[model samples]
Target: MESEAGEREPVIIAFCCHYCAFTAADLAGTMRQQYPTNIRIVRLPCTGKVYVNMLLEAFVDGADGVMVAGCEEGSCHFLEGNYRAKKRVNYAKQKIEEVGINPEKLEMYHIGASEGPLFARKAREFTERIRKLMQEENEPENQIQNEK
Candidate 1:
């Protein structure tokens, strides 16, 4: 579902590796597949290049959820870039949660060329999760914080 103007749409930013996940996303688009429209895919040369601050910036800029998609384990075009990304994501997840957002808001997935369908499915599933999170847990705390 598309986010409306007044209602905060679950904004999801997907950081995808150029070699695998990004290409698969493009293929999903080419195949005329319909996935959640809320996800915005950003292509990175490797997941390793994504910094912790970059993920935080997405939330600061209105992203309700963030996802990093890279090549399957031991299948990176850049050898171990995805491994580095996994570590960074874990750190960022903790940091984000400490700052009052749910750590589940951030996720990581690895897929090969043949997993475009899975990529699409993941996007859908993440979007749903974000939607539910937003509905159930987003308001009370923010409302209290805003009153202060």
Candidate 2:
């Protein structure tokens, strides 16, 4: 990942459920919680609405990582929606791994609607994780090993 000036950074995409994670993200902004701006959020009616293809497409479109954020287990407005999303995210992870992509690039998170600071923290943590992963990949030793 890189900035316009080629400075290191990470671009992450977060798919959030309207009933939970999305509201938390909105509240995070109002709460002035400091987080990296590199996380791009896509609000969905339910996390279950996300398809495996969509996750893969985000990667293809240059996202360094992707997150699926939704209601916690047993707390979804739509029964089992979060569970369904978790399953899909896991499946997507396996697909990416099969293609030689790092499975760490995707994650599923459970967030409460009122957890504003938590949302912000997650955004920052994911961005950092991606940044470190990218740094490791770009290291001279890693390049030489990969080229061998």
Candidate topping TM-score: 2
Q: How close to the true structure is residue 1 of candidate 1, measured as C-alpha lDDT?
A: 45
Candidate 2, 27-142: lDDT as tens digits? 99999998898889999999989899999999999888999999988999899999999999999999999976789989999999999999999998888888888888889998
What is residue 58's positional error in candidate 1, in angstroms? 0.8
> Lowest summed-lDDT stretch of 10 residues in model 2?
1-10
**lDDT by residue for model 1 (1-148), tens:** 4456565778799999999999888888888778988999999999989899999999999999999999999999999999999999999999998988899999999977667788898999999999988877648987677467
Off by over 4 Å in 2: 1-6
Per-candidate Cα lDDT values, in order, are 0.90, 0.92
Model 2: number of backbone collisions: 0
Model 2 lDDT at residue 24: 95
Highest-scoring model, lDDT? 2
Give the lDDT of residue 61 in candidate 1.
97
What TM-score would every model get versus the actual structure?
0.89, 0.93
